[model samples]
Target: MKKIALMGRSEAGKTTLTQALKGEKIHYHKTQYVNNFDVIIDTPGEYAQTHGLGHALALYAYEADIVGLLVASNEPYCLFPPCSTCTANREVIGIVTKIHAPDGKPERAASWLRLAGCKKIFYVDSKTQEGIPEILEYLKEDGDVLPWETKPEADGKKRANELPQEESQ
Candidate 1:
């Protein structure tokens, strides 16, 4: 079964994002498993972008086929540092979280995430269920950035510098 690990700091909405992908909101752990296309393991939240918990979980997600990283949009750098993790593996996908506000729109959201090197970033509104299907299609499609390239490509980033790494906040 293909595995999609949702990695991010606490309160970043990894659990909520997983629930959206699964099409359910049952009470319990936020982690979810729905069909073979999607599977997310909810890791603890990390408010800051440092070592220990945050680093450990990032590594764990890197090992998986796909990593849906959740980051709060308002946070400085918008948690862009983690987007660099995408360079570690081709399966990495950046996801902005907690974006349900009057000003929460795709244009700005995409811009923030883009600074982190995510060309195919997808937004998630934990409170309203927006942009969930886009993520689902991304997952079911096997994490391919190119809509036409169903197969993995060798041009994927090989190192962190190969990915987007703006100055961390």
Candidate 2:
């Protein structure tokens, strides 16, 4: 499964999403520091909110296969600017939480993520497990391979971890 790093503003449901993904009972737990799990990295909202600590999130992004930029449906403002995903070397996706909130505007939140360059966006209400299966399916996909790391086999299939042989002079 692809390792994912979740980043968002305070009360964005990063911790709740982490628990739901792990199949643990959802509980309220403040994330004071980066929690590195086997397949997930849960970061404190302060890291994303404070300009000085934002660098820490970038550093952690390196350790993940996918970087998830989360936004609550009811947020009045977006923290990320246009084309924010360009700064990430890894695949960047958007997760819109609180889809079932009384005053939520999921579509608006999704638009913000789209502007930020998220190739794909998912709407989830962790409390009810909505959209959770889709996330699981995404994580189960095979990790990406660099062009130089794959070699074409005789069967016309690309195989990873096998470099092409050099041509003889």
Candidate 3:
């Protein structure tokens, strides 16, 4: 699975979203520091709320395969610039959380993410696990065949000829 690094504000539900994606029960846990998990990297909301800590996300991005810029549907302003300043080599995606909020504005939040340079965006409600499957599907698709990877068939084994030259030697 492609590891996801979540970037968002304190109330954006980054930790809850991580639990939802992992198929765990939703629970409140204040993220004080960067927590590296098997499939997700949960960062403190201060990283996005504080301008000084914004650059730190780039350094953390190196530890994950995907960088997810999160925006809650109820957010009044865009934390990200018109275009993403992230310098990570990996793909950047967006996640709009708290879509179930009464005052949530999914459309507006999605627009902000687009302006932030997210190639793909997902809207999810962690509490109900709504829209979570789509994210899982996307992550699965990412494993299909990377540019430098060899395609694997249904079987559990790879043919000798299918191995890369460097590995074959």
Residue 91 Cα positional deviation in candidate 1, in Å, after optimal superposition: 2.6
Top candidate when judged by TM-score against the true structure: 2
| Candidates 1 and 3 compared by TM-score, better number | 3
Measured on C-alpha atoms, candidate 1 has an lDDT of 0.60
Error of 3 at 111 (Å): 0.3
| Runs with alpha carbons beyond 4 Å of true place in candidate 2 | 142-169
State in Å the error of residue 24, model 2.
0.6
RMSD of 1: 14.3
Itemize residue pairs with steric clashes in candidate 3.
none
Q: Write candidate 2's Cα lDDT for 5-55 as tens digits.
A: 999999999999999888789999999999999889999999999999999
lDDT digits (tens) for residues 1-169 of candidate 1 = 3467766655667776766666677244633322223366666555234565455665665556776666666554455553475465646667887687554554555676566666667777866778876776666644334333343347863443233446532
Question: What's each prediction's TM-score?
Answer: 0.62, 0.83, 0.80
lDDT (C-alpha) at residue 16 in model 1: 66
Model 2 weakest lDDT span, ten residues long = 142-151
Reference-based lDDT, residue 46, model 3? 99
Per-residue error at 72 for model 3, in Å?
0.4
Name the weakest run of 10 consecutive residues (lDDT summed) in model 1. Answer: 29-38
